[model samples]
Target: MNKIERIGVYTSGGDAPGMNAAIRAVVRTALYNGIKVTGIYRGYEGMIEGDFKEMVSRSVSSILQKGGTILKSARCAEFRTPEGRQKAYDQVKAAGIDALVAIGGDGTFTGAELFSKEFDIPVMCIPGTIDNDLYGSDYTLGFDTANNTVIDAIDKIKDTAASHNRLFFVEVMGRDSGCIALNAGVAGGAEALMLPEKDTAIEELIDSLEEARERNKTSMIVIVAEGDKNGGAYNVAKRVKEKFDFYDTKVSILGHLQRGGSPSSFDRVLATRMGYFAVNELIRGNRSATVGIRGSQIVSTSLEEALRGKELKLDEELLKIAQVMNI
Candidate 1:
């Protein structure tokens, strides 16, 4: 493989906290290895449009604690087309970017996998989504921060819930995976949780709430994942009210609120470690792979293996704990 002279780094898909930390790590790690760094704005769109900026060490200064990516992120439909990818490759060649560090979730990795294989360019990916659904890693870049944000919202909502003797159905992001909902629900001491990975019937949910009420629980909180089989929080709240109306019902859809926040220290450190590993892996002549942590050790998985359609099973133990604790 040709020596990696310069690396292009970009973030794509939904914005996540600690993405800036990943970018900083990539830029600084590349510079540390005597390699040039180019920041690609707007992900694949920037690559196609030639929106490139030379990044020095100071370019990422004071951004470690910042939420969202300094490099920014966007969905690029054009990147899916061969013609558009060719244009991106032409621009990449013109800019002398020999390798790439792609920071995003599955979509980002898909693009990188295709781009690298077609053009024979080295690429590395960092799992940067808050969903934490990726198969290869125990934790993604912004999962911790997103959970923290949800828990904070849940705690505040609980305060009002108790005061008004209300039942709150708090909806959190997790269209495909229920990691955020499960983690935050357990941490926030919710009365019940509806997860995407599990089929929760409305009647069953009502039964749990009925039990809570029987136990003389004043305030009730039901954490709902957006992709729950029984619809979202609003619909679930409506269904529950029809059957059981002992308490005032409120629906709090914490839509994008879970997506924005200062990343927790855990996320910052995780992003930093993943970012640093991605750059060094590219320099080590790995053509296409993803960096992730497994049991506290940084590791690389081939892009194909990482992106393969493996079922990301939910933590069964955690699920059981959440269920048992609800009583």
Candidate 2:
């Protein structure tokens, strides 16, 4: 519709594992279509600073197996201001970038959505947070890799836990979402999981652990999401140790570790498909939307719908499985 010639791409917000794969797909897909591509460094901050580089297919080569974004990412509080957006818009026009492919989580989409409306340019987003908290996409880019990374740590911790007959309180990143805590808890075979979505009181936790002790369980592992109301794993462990002293308790905060890893086959393929879909949508004149995979199909959702803070329902089935598995 805009007779597009050149496109720009950038990653913002927290970096994720499969972001490199998505970047690769975007660059190669646009190049294959005979369109020029520009890589914007450090997201909106880079855009405002005019930090850009022309990207060729080779620029993204051999990066599919890497973690994090090649374009890099940063928070740009300045970009939230009208003046900042104006400066970014001017830079985009001067760089001859008619449309854009943005890869990041909600903050990235909010920026792209606002910038596109202000300047009337096309922008498509790929959800790229390890948290997988985005609404439009069922699975965000690095979620699988992050989940795998967490499970790996948990498995190792489990070995030591069994040997020492210890109780481990493992904290994982999710911020306000519990997706990671729930999925990783199930996969890691955690004894209990505390999520932000539900109120998991210390009393209930102590009761569960007591039950486990009664069953002659010598070791325990509890997975806590960062947003849990009972504070983090440290606080939870401290409180539990005060009441239930059945096993020696230890705390492990798997902070940024989950955000780094060679993405699994699932994440790599998902990123590639999302990136390809985003470019194709932009070519077809679609804009101000995000590309997502819902039930094995690639689909697009408007940024308005995506940014409404619509929470994905907690996995009830998984919760049931987690409960049953513990017994």
Candidate 3:
């Protein structure tokens, strides 16, 4: 680990817009230090099948603005098996890999930790999920871009809501976390925000819509996370309509739309910073740790600390702002 000779990089889970930016940073920085880089295609599945290619400085050139992982990504539950993990380790040894860089979220980081522990090799993780659910880092690599995407869609939906004087329910991607929904709700000036962390006050929500009506408000927008306990948006909308006797409610599930598009200026910068710092950490002999941006500093803790399933807490200040703006 003194001098990185060859490093392998892989991405797992859903593809994020800023993934290529992270891969580019890792390759460019590693090559700058005279290290060989190998791209693991389709995640660890590619590792077992030997579906990898040598990555050069030119391989990732001009990919900073790209929207997907250059190495691609996947879920290889097979890799969890001892035989499968052994195959991956054997492949790495055969390919002369000195270190590994894994760009992904909680599940992916846990797998990287397991691989590193078994092989006793350095593994660095760059958080790349749009969910922004990963703990430790204030922001994941693709979050800014996804937030921008979510708010952009919300803005467009606003025009239609105002045109028809209707209530619009906009559901965003947040499997078990609501950082995306909560942040976008505040930014988009949504009336009520629903997240997995808290229960939605349907009675209060109905009263708010009634109040908006009494005040001659033309439109109301509710931002609900996909993981919200109330169920999918359509079911919630139906319940709202039935209980409140309100019709003409529009449902707009942002779905994977928020995960597409080019990496924004903020996401690109964050990814590059994380990627370069991760390589440096491995050079310093760090293993079983996930490099994360903690309070504007690149500090990392044990992957064990990361796997505790801690979720990002909502910023109450932003919630306050959202409430004040709605008033």
Candidate 4:
């Protein structure tokens, strides 16, 4: 699609909706190409600890639309250390893996790169996290599902906000990236959006709310990224309450909810296409690259390039749209 037989697949970091579908895609694609695939449980922790099982045609028969990762996932703090990562390298050689596919977020890519360099084993990093924060790509695999999840949650919360004539501070996952906050803010019709790129000033928010209220906007909802300087939406809500007599603001952090749910149409299709391509790339003897969605195509970038810090920059154009829409 050539040399990736007995490939080992692992999902590291947090679990997400499309991970299982991705796993299915890889396993099916590899098998169709006459290669064997093994699923590693609990990420690098499992790999270092040697917890792997052969993944067969039936192993992922019904997982294409599943919410969580079939292989499971975990943060391997141990694997980050040189000794722990070395152990993982030893395990890879011990397993006879010609190439490895790691599915997870940024930390997972860094770990895969370290192991790839140490063992001289080709490791492919697949973007499978809901955070959508990975550099070098416009979108991560689980982002569409996560964004839809946020929109659904916001729509539900907005009803309550308007009914009670209160302000809403909805926190979304972004950590250091703020992609989720920014996207969901625009999609959910948030009155104000706060991301990690800019300072979360209380005075500015208070002023905005004051103006909206005076203009007969009885209810307002604001979106905040988790890593915003003023803290999560809960903390921002508390600040608003302290600054004004209206203590009716409520905070809702979508949290892991966005990470679960059936993979959306976009995610399932993207995962399937990428899954097929990952195996094909490995067959072509490509390695140490993280495949990403660039525009409308699937492209490969060396892990070294993907790792060189693609800082998340908010679309200032979207900011202008948000302002124009007054959301």
- Candidate 2, residues 1-327, lDDT tens digits: the string is 767789999999999988999999999999999999999999999999999999999999899999988898899999999999999989989999999999999899999999999889999999999898888878999999999999999999999999999999999997788899999899999999999999989999999999998899999999999999999999999999999888999999999989987999999999999999999999998978998989999999999999995668888999999999997
Please provide, for model 4 over 164-210, each residue's C-alpha lDDT reduced to its tens digit, 9 standing for 90 to 100. 99888888888787778878888888889888888969989898888
lDDT tens string, model 3, 16-41?
88889889888988888888899989
Model 2 stretches astray by more than 4 angstroms: none
Q: What is the lDDT of residue 248 in candidate 3?
A: 74
Model 1, span 1-327: residue lDDT tens: 778899999999998999999999999998998999999999999999999999999999999999988888889999999999999999999999999999999999999999999999999999999999887889998999999999989999999999999999999999999999999999999999999999989999888888888999999999999999989999999989999999999999999977788889999999999999999888778899999999989999999999895889999999999989988
Candidate 4, run of 10 with poorest lDDT: 244-253
> What TM-score does candidate 2 reach?
0.99
Question: What are the TM-scores, per candidate, against the unseen true structure?
Answer: 0.99, 0.99, 0.96, 0.96
Question: What's the true lDDT of residue 170 in model 2?
Answer: 97
What local lDDT does model 3 show for residue 14? Answer: 88
lDDT of candidate model 1 versus the reference: 0.93
Colliding pairs, model 4? 2-283
Clashing pairs in 1: none
lDDT of 4: 0.85
